[model samples]
Target chain A: MDRSVLSIIKCFGTELYNALKDAQDDISEIRIRKEKSVVVYKQNIPYAVTKQGLTALELDNAKNEYITVSEALIKDAFAQLCSYSVYRFQNDINNGFITVNGGHRIGICGTYVGENGIMRSVRDITSLNIRIAREYKGCSRKLADIAGCEGGILICGVPSTGKTTMLRDISRLFSTEKMLKVSVVDERGELSAYSHTSNGFDLGLCDIYCGYPKQKAVICAVRTMSPDFIVCDELTGEDIESVCFTVNYGVKMIASVHCDSLENGLKNVSLFRLLKTGAFNKVVFLNRSIIGKIDAVYNIGDIQKLYE
Target chain B: MNNMKIIGAVLIILTSWLTGIMLSKRLSQREELLIELKQLLSEIKRRITYEMPTMCDLISNCGTQYLKPFTDNMYNSLSGGYTINESVISAVADTPLLCVLQDCEKQLITDVLSSLGAADSTSVREITDSAIIQLDHYIGLAQENRQKNSKVYFVTSLYIGFAAVILMI
Candidate 1:
């Protein structure tokens, strides 16, 4: 079991903690909603938590016995997540999620309290989705060649297709195996999960910039760390300007984008713009069947010519 | 026989004087503790305005000797998953030095601690500022009591001792 996931489970009610503790290694996500059955997702399969153990909850079966999450449980979990100090997590609460010490991102939903149309905080929380972070050490070994001999590679995949996990391994391999100075711009702290309580995954020889905005972190890394390559997750349209600017500094880039298929990836304006900068020469499509498996690798020029 | 009587009279006066000093020190100690609390609240306000440390950091890292045990108790209770109010109450009960505080003053301190880490920076600043003012009032009252009664305790206890000695003689 991931130590961070275990620490998180300890924050739950005793019964829930015991029920989930034994199966934490295989569990990926824990969905907690107020006054509802707690659901744990293992290998993308949903199971309702029961005292005996995890039971596969069927959609048509209304009589399945499961522990229903209460308001008190939700309140206690929120307090524990905040470390009993709500003021410390106010900014994260305003953003609708709080990342715990081990890089597990907890998605929070609640009534929004706003001032001048800007969110100040969230109250009366209705649900929390705790996404566990798992490190697959050799997950990117198959892509070691592509990761190492890269001008730039755009890894595209849908949500839950293991893009982040692949990125983490590739980062570790590049830093340790290839003996390159790699910088991970961890905007959401997911990549590094560096907190006071826990030092997250070992991305060997990689300099992690946690909780930095992607563009700013890239600029800082180039100026300060002088890393051979910069890796970041989930680039959107807003990052195009900075990414393009950073690539001009002779540093390589490895980034991910959200696209379900190769055709749509070429159609993505941000991906097109990113490729037009000549930063990325190849696009690697990841498959959901086996995480980190490259479905196809396309040359940017060939794809452009074919599409045109 | 005369030397023994002189020694006994001297012992009575000294013991009474010592008792007076001990009684006066209690009020002074309360005054000093109130002053420390005011300083702590001011420091808390400054940190909230500038550094914005979490409650755990604020309490556990506070280096003041008098409040160290008190804050340590609170820190342990919070880490043990106790509620804010419960932590403060437990800390107060566990701390011997805080027992010097009057009931109302302790209640005010409890309110200040309970309110912290439960709100935003602005609201927390306001709470600490308010707490500082109330602490200042308590300090003033304690100071006045110490100033007014310290001499009386010494003089009255000495007079009683002298009367006892004279009657014995």
Candidate 2:
């Protein structure tokens, strides 16, 4: 396990840190709620974390024995996550999560405070769901040849199906191996996680723009970086115009969307509009059981035919 | 015997005069410290309002050496994994630069440090503004005390030394 990943959970204090330290390699997510048993997901399986270690017993049965999260722990962790500066992360807090070092995304649940019926920032934190980011180097080797093609690729999958890992690896491969100019617009800082204190993940010659909104980043990359391929994560409805603009500007895009099947993927208004742009030539769907294994691939023309 | 007595009298007067100067200089030093503290708080308020930087970044970028001890302790403690409140409290306690502050002034500084990053920009600004006002009050008091008592201390000590010397003679 990377030491930085373990260091992030240290804000919960020493007891939880010690219990999770040895099992951190397999840990995928940690869910913390005040006055609730601290549950950790190990390779997609939930296990209650006790003072001794991870327990296989169900949370309800072992509630007495499990290490319960406290309000103090949550407060301390929230402060630590903000780096002792609430004002600095107001936007991230308003968005309901903050990406910390090592690219771990902590989903914050709290009371929203605002004025005149407008939602502003979160306060009185009650729960935090930490999704641990893992990098599988060379995971996109199978898709490397397809990535070298002239057009773009759209990756689709349910949550935790290795969409991000594939995008990361493909970016690395194209930038370094194929000697192509790749621009990664990391909106949430997860893909690159680059910070002042950390170098984050090695994307192999990719020029990363961290924390830029996807649409803006695409335009900026097209104008400034002149990248052969513009890679980003999680395309939404607001990005359709920019996607078309970038595709018309003659830059290939590699991005991901949340979908289980090709039919369901087309149902997404934004993804459907994206396909209509003729930007991506192929849509790659990932399988859940196998992290990086591609479940299906379809040509864009075929998808367009199916949609019509 | 007359020469010895003259030398002794000169020595006593000189020693007492030096003591008086030292006492007056302490008052001046206290006043200067308060003034600097006020300036520091104002700078912090401006930065918090404009940049909203982390506490560590704020202190590191402050670029003033007068509060170096406090800043250094803050940086080390915050980096050492202490919570911001704990780090601020410990840093304030450890810094010798803050020693000149009276109980109320010290409490004021502690409140400022403790509340700096604990709230939103508006709230932090409000806290800092309040602290700065209190600091200004203290500065005024210190300045008044220095001006009023510095000469008193000097003259009283000098006269006492003179009286002792005359009696000895």
RMSD to truth, every model? 2.8, 2.4
Residue A182's lDDT in candidate 1 = 93
TM-score of each: 0.90, 0.92
Q: TM-score of chain A for each candidate?
A: 0.93, 0.96
Candidate 1: how many backbone clashes? Answer: 0
Regions of model 1 farther than 4 Å from truth: A59-64, B1-16, B45-54, B64-66, B160-169
DockQ of each: 0.54, 0.67
Encode model 2's per-residue lDDT on A130-196: one tens digit a residue: 9888788889988766545688999999887788888888888899888999999998999987887
Global CA lDDT of candidate 1, please? Answer: 0.82
* Model 1 interface CAPRI class: medium
Best by lDDT: 2
Clashing pairs in 1: none
Clashing pairs in 2: none
A300 Cα displacement, candidate 1 (Å) = 2.2
Query: lDDT at B166 for candidate 2?
Result: 82
